[model samples]
Target: MTAPITQLKTIEQQLLWLSHWMIHHANHVRPKVDDIKVGGHQASSASMVSIMTALYFSALRPEDRVAVKPHASPVFHAIQYLMGNQTRDRLEKFRGLGGAQSYPSRTKDTNDVDFSTGSVGLGVAITSFASLVQDYIAAKPWGETLPKGRMVALVGDAELDEGNVYETLQEGWKNDLRNCWWIIDYNRQSLDGVVREGLFERIEKIFDAFGWDVVRVKHGVLQRAAFAKPGGDKLRNWIDTCPNQQYSALTFMGGAVWRKRLMDDLGDQGDVTALLERHSDSELAALMENLGGNCVETMAEAFASIDHDRPTCFLAYTIKGVVTLTCRQSAKASR
Candidate 1:
């Protein structure tokens, strides 16, 4: 059990490293013929590494299917590369003629991708339809041998705004959907700017109304544990109330500022105060930054706990740019 979690962590680290490395290799190492940016969404991938790690290495079985988020293509490729499901040549020539597609393609890419994703909300919405399709097939006689797998979508938080997503909700509700998981990357940051406030609140109610179980993966195991302590409540409250921009800004500024911000908000009280005091600035930042979506163990555990196979929505909190450097730099520079 723990072994898979260890592998999940390793996978997360490798995705982080390789995703960045791939972009670096493309920009710095490879020869440039055109002036066009070899633009890879680094920040996007960074935000998704832990979720992918948990989903691929731990929670997912051979039967389960995933539609990789468009921006996290590097991470997906890295995982497939590590698993020997992809070739070295593909990695070496990413975004090239014969390389992996900018976004995964079920028909185009060589990897065993369940759903090909390019457009934002389309991919997310499709997962629900796919689950309905699976159920339709299972009802028939010939497809009885079809594996009992969940149709999962790794969705960007921004993608939720797309009208197709709501259309998907209505469709799923109508079809009596089951065995589907829409894991939203609630990073709050998007390509243009940070997401609107209370976006997930509306999403939660929508999911519930549509007969989906809404599981908000806001805090990881560590943060949840910390919240149980004395001053932990205040810290948790601060985190809960902190605007997306502030969180992203604090993260970009680094750990020292994170410590000051946490202390300034929560103050030095008792057990929670002691807990905060014990950690260095960097440590405190790391603690503060542990979004549930970025915690592989927590995600894997969450994925494992589901039994009834209701159409589920995991509102997974993440950073905007988790996997790639190019995206991180761009987002920061833009800000």
Candidate 2:
């Protein structure tokens, strides 16, 4: 790994631990006045950690602004704490009265939150408007002196179901929005369940119609490297064709299940079988689970590859609670 990638991975792990720990502390350790459970979206925060780490630590400039996903408040607050923008007391008081707000708030939060995000799709919608406003300011003589920056939204995949997001897309198309980015955490799994298969195809079409560039980040470095092997193409095809729920379940079930499924499907094929034999169960499991959005290096590369000022959407594939799963596996192995 490059020095930058190493640094990013370290930061990613720290954010993952801090965010989950904050949630655990809130739910289990903190003194409660009532019998209510203090719910923090631990999985949601885990899904965004690598993406946010790449964005904030590697890709983002000082002028850029981001509207963090509402459910990822823990990750955002953890990032702020790492940057010395948040206090330890506030972190300990997460979700409590006079504590870190359940969701990021511009008026309430002491840290530098560019956009207050709480409503389902409001955070995703506002980035386009903010980009428009930025353009409007630049058109003015005095405002031309201000530095222009990208208005970005860290969006949850489920948030795309909101009608207002589509409405904002139409408005943005009409207004010719520029320098806006919506990075969707396309984890497939949502609160209700796994999202409908092929949702990304429809989403791509919608964005294309609205004059926005769509970048689909599906596979990570590990998967891509495997695909370059002798029987890698067949393996890649199998992964591509696998149903979303099945893939998720297999991932949860870990490597032995993956081996069985792959062997059953592609057993007689000499090259494919050899490829499977190359890796142990845990290694195979890790390879299969390393989706693009969950890989900090892959996310950083995606962010860096965007060379235009036009509005863009990065549909980044990830796994919900992947960080938590990894931590659990690590603990189990250590025990």
Candidate 3:
């Protein structure tokens, strides 16, 4: 790995540990007067760790603004804590009264939160309007000196179901939106259940129709490298055609099950069999789960590859709760 990528990996793990620790502390360590569970959304925060790390550490600039996904508040608070913008006391009291806000809040959060995000689709919808407002200000004579910045929304795929998001898309198209980015965490699983298969295809079409560039960030470096191997095409095809729930289940089951499934499916092909034998169960699991948005290096590269100011939507594939599971396993091992 390059120096920058190595550094990013370190930071990614730190953020993951800190974020999960904060959630665990809130639920298990902190004394509770009531019987209510202090839900910190550990899985939601884990899914966004890589994307947020890459965006904040590698892709974002000082002037850029972001409306973080509501469920990712733990990760956001962890980031702020690392940057010395949040206090440990607040983290210890997560989801409690006078504690860290359940969501990123401009008014409530002491840290630098560009936009307050709470309601499902509201945060995602407002970024386009924020971008338009920025443009309007920049066009005026008095506002000529203002530095232009990207208005970004870190969105959850489930948030796409909101009618307001589509309404904003139409409004943005009508107003000629620019300098905006909506990076969707396409983890395939939501609070209700697995997302519908092929929903991304429809999402891409909608973005294209709205004059926004759609970038599908699917495979990570490992998967892309694996695909270049002799039997890699079949593996790639299998991943592409695999149902969302099946893939998620395999991921949750870990590397041994992944190996068994792959062997059962592609064992007859000599080249594919050789490819499968190249890695142990743990290695195989990591490789299979390393989706683009979950890999910090891949996400950084994707963000860097975008050169235009036009509104863009990055449909980034990720494994929901991957980091949290890893953290739990590690904790058990240490114990």
**lDDT for model 3:** 0.86
lDDT of 3 at 168: 98
What candidate 3 gets wrong by more than 4 Å, as runs, is: 1-3, 324-335
- What is candidate 2's lDDT per residue for 1-335, written digit by digit as tens? 22277677788899999998888999899988887999999988988998999899988878899999999999999999999999989999999877788999998889989999989799999999999999999999989999889999999999999999999999999999999999999988887888998888998999999999999888877778788878999999998899888887888897899999999988769988878777778878877887888778788899999988989999998888784223222222222
Residue lDDT tens for model 1, 1-335: 43365556656777798888887777677777877778788888888988888788777878788988998899999999998999878877788778877899987899888888888888898888888888889989999888878989998888887998899899889889888998988888876787888867877898899999988888876677677766777888888899988887887777688877776876666765677766665556566677788777678888877878888888888777642221122222112
Residue 316, model 2, lDDT = 90
Could you tell me which residue pairs clash in candidate 3? none
TM value for model 3: 0.95
| Candidate ordering by lDDT (highest first) | 2, 3, 1
> Candidate 3 residues 1-335, lDDT tens each?
12287677778899999888988888889999987888888888888998998898899989899999999999999899989999999988888877788898888888988888988899998899999999899999999899899999999999999999999999999999999999999998888988998888988999999999998898877778788888989999999888989988899887889988987877769988877777666667877887888888788888998889999999989988874223222222112
The 0-to-1 C-alpha lDDT of every candidate, in the order given, reads 0.79, 0.87, 0.86
**RMSD of each candidate?**
5.4, 3.6, 4.1
Give candidate 3's error at residue 8 in angstroms: 0.8
Show model 2 residue runs off by greater than 4 Å.
1-3, 324-335
**Pairs of colliding residues, candidate 1:** 42-324, 43-321, 43-322, 45-323, 46-322, 46-323, 47-322
Cα displacement (Å) at residue 299, model 2:
0.5
